[model samples]
Target: MRLLILGTGGMANAHAKNFSAIDGVEVVGGVDVDPSRVEAFNAMHNIPHGFGSLDAALNWGEFDAIANVTPDSVHHPTTMAALAAGKHVFCEKPLATDYARAIEMTEAAEAAGVVAMVNLTYRNVAQLQKARELVQAGELGKVKHFEASYLQSWLVSKAWGDWRTESQWLWRLSKKHGSNGTLGDIGIHILDFAVYGAGSDIDKVFCRLETFNKAEGDRIGEYDLDANDSFAMTAQLENGALGVVHATRWATGHFNELRLRVYGERGSVEVQHRHDWSKLFTCLGDDAETGKWTETEVPSVPTNYERFFEAVQMGRTLEPSFRHATSLQRVLDLSMLTDRDRREHEVYL
Candidate 1:
């Protein structure tokens, strides 16, 4: 498969690495707005065709797929153009900044009869899949509660300096980029994973999103700031399972800590990140307290990015299908759309 990667950001770099290693796939070209970025991508990956604008890649005739790894602000435009031009598209997550555009993008893909995939990479985690399988096989019985969190300290202190200083968190904070802050970033990931692992859809959500700190002066550039750094939500799934999802960029100690736990009638399972220790532990029901936890040791499966190309080659379903991606976006929209006064409204079963 010949692919055109449309960004030279960090995520794009990761995608390039994976695509380069895939047996039948070739990253034919790349496009980035910055000349330095495009040049760097071509230099590092040895890609033959490098263009300074997405328009060049869109007009290029040799590419079979377009990877829209650009920033959140331009995802819709790039993906739509790629789909309209008869190229299959694989977009980074939070497909578009908002729900309506996300719907439009998917509809256009369907209308054009092109394959579209969203990069919800966490779903491809092998241990998470094992958790899903265990739930479905009744090993965990009736799921009662689900909790997942993505905690990162990357934005904990603006004084220490970070990539965010380049732009006053506008890409994540502005309405033009879709929803504000964590709801669109880390929150959406956990929401999708929760629904995927639980095999259910969220019927309703009650969220409390906040921005505790603001850019003090003019150092963080100039942008209309109306986004949150943290969000906590309680969701009621269609399957009678309750869930809590919390995502924050302000956590002090955790650096990209992602953890998930599910409690069910027969047992419970938990997963913790960055630990060489047994990643999954299940507590099956028993009368006595004699070490009821089942220690399921999971060997890390190979990363899922390359598998995406393999699936594309075989015409198989992508891990988080495009429809699933849309559903995840819907949950995000509903949560973030709640009025400020009702951000913490309760949903009773």
Candidate 2:
């Protein structure tokens, strides 16, 4: 499949590289607002075409699919446009900053009958897959509780946005941009992976959000620092399980760590995926050493890029689709709105 990657962010480059490495995929053109970055990205990837905007690319680019790699703000519009044009799309997560807009995007894609998937990349993690299998196979029988977190130290200092030449590390801190900072960014991944692996849906959320690392003085720039840097929530699952989910960008020692443990009546499983290493532990109900944990091998899952191409080329439905993001979007939207005024919020379906 030939593709046009919108937005010249680092993720755009990653998409280009991943697609290029696929068996029969090509990055035909790229679109970015910055002309210099457009030229640079194309030169770096050796793509045959470049455009100044998505409108221009949609008008003239030769591609059957689009990779919406833009910021969270533009996800709704760009993806809607791509679906309207009858093109398949691989959009970034959160679907949109607004729940209504996310619904519209998913509906548009569904109406178009196009393969649309949100870039919930962690869905491809092998350990998470293994955990999901354990839950599905009843190894962890009747899950009763769960604890999940995605932590990173990038926002502790000011180097979070040093990689990309955009927003001065404050877009996430902006209401007009990110809406829900750490929650929307990485916390959504925790919600997604935990529920996904546990094969359950969250039914309620009681949240606590913090802005401990808010920008001060000259650091605010043009963006507002009202967005949260850390968030902790107690979630009640549809399966009557109480779970804790936490995300913080100021986690001092952690680079990027996603850990989840699901406790069931008979057995339990703990899965950890870190930037450096990953591990999964399980305990069967009949283990003689009652509280013992044994390391289990993680299942090897396929990459999203490979799955996306396969879905597009084979006319199959995209798992972790925009629909899934819309589901997660509601959680983020409510998380953004939940505060001292409204302490506990019920997760809608």
Candidate 3:
């Protein structure tokens, strides 16, 4: 299996390195609008061919897969073009800046009959993998409640000066460019991994959105700060489990933390991020009340790139497929509507 990376951003290196490490997979080329960035990326990663534009990569046509790690706004166009060119796609999360475009992208991939996977990075967390396995194996019985949060302090521009001065984060706060803001960036991942761990889909959402302290005039450049800094929602799953979901870049003490806990009839499981990694805990049996939580050692698992290559080789749909992404987008779309009316919205998939 051969691949073409779609961007020269920070994540493109990880993609190139991880795929290149696989025995049968090769990263044949890379595409980026900036020729100098492309040059640097190739120099750093040894990607044999680099293209100034995606069209160039499409014309070269030597790869069977696309690692679509481009910006939020351009995901739809890049993934669609690659899919149309008869390549499988591994897209970065928040499938598109807009929900409608996300739907269209998934539909196109399905119609093209290619395996598709969204890089919901949280799903790759070792502890979360254990949580997912526990949920599926009934070690956690029928889940009754779920709670998750992803918090970060990057937007605490005081420590790093104004992030609005940086090119990397400027567009991320734009309503048109960033779309749902922190919700799309970090919130979607919480919802994704929560749904994955719970072994069900969310059916409704009642949400609160905040753009509070991060104001439009507070930025350095002529930037758009229309996106939210935080979002919290109460969600109901298809399995009758209730949950709370939260994501923010404003939590003062948290550098970056994502935590998830699920309670079921027979057991309960929890996972927490620590220093960019994770820890898993499980409480089972009648000892649940009296016994201390036992830390479950998470086993090793394949990287998203490895899974993508495996799916391509096996001719099967990948886990956390484009279909799942559309459902997650449904939750986000309805959450926006819920915020508007201050009412619960059905997540109609």
Tens digits of lDDT, candidate 3, 1-349: 9888999898888888888899998888888999999999988888899999888888889889899989888898888888889899999887886678888988998899999998887777888888888899998789999999988887874554557567677677777555668888887888987888888899889999988656547454666687888999999999999999999888887887889999999899999984556899889887587856988887778877788899999978787788788788878888888999999988774
Question: Which of 2 and 3 is ahead in lDDT?
Answer: 3
Q: Please list the C-alpha lDDT of all candidates, in the order they appear.
A: 0.76, 0.83, 0.85
- TM-scores for all candidates: the values are 0.90, 0.94, 0.95
Report the C-alpha displacement of residue 112, candidate 3, in angstroms: 1.4
In model 1, the number of clashes is 0
- The root-mean-square deviation over C-alpha atoms between each candidate and the true structure, in angstroms, is 3.1, 2.1, 1.8
lDDT ranking, best first: 3, 2, 1
The alpha-carbon deviation from the true structure for residue 324 of candidate 2, after best TM-score superposition, in angstroms, is: 1.0
Which candidate wins on TM-score?
Answer: 3
Off by over 4 Å in 1: 157-164, 168-170, 173-179, 217-219, 275-278, 285-291, 339-349
lDDT of 1 by residue, 1-349 (tens): 8989998887898889888988888988989888888898889998999988877776666988888888887889888888889888888988877778888888998788767888887765666777878888887778888998888776765543564655524566655545457888877688877777776778878888887655665124545456777888888778889889898978887766677888887778776664233266777768114647665777666555665676667766465556667777777777766645576433323
Please give the range of 10 consecutive residues that has the lowest summed lDDT in model 1: 340-349
In terms of lDDT, the best-performing candidate is: 3
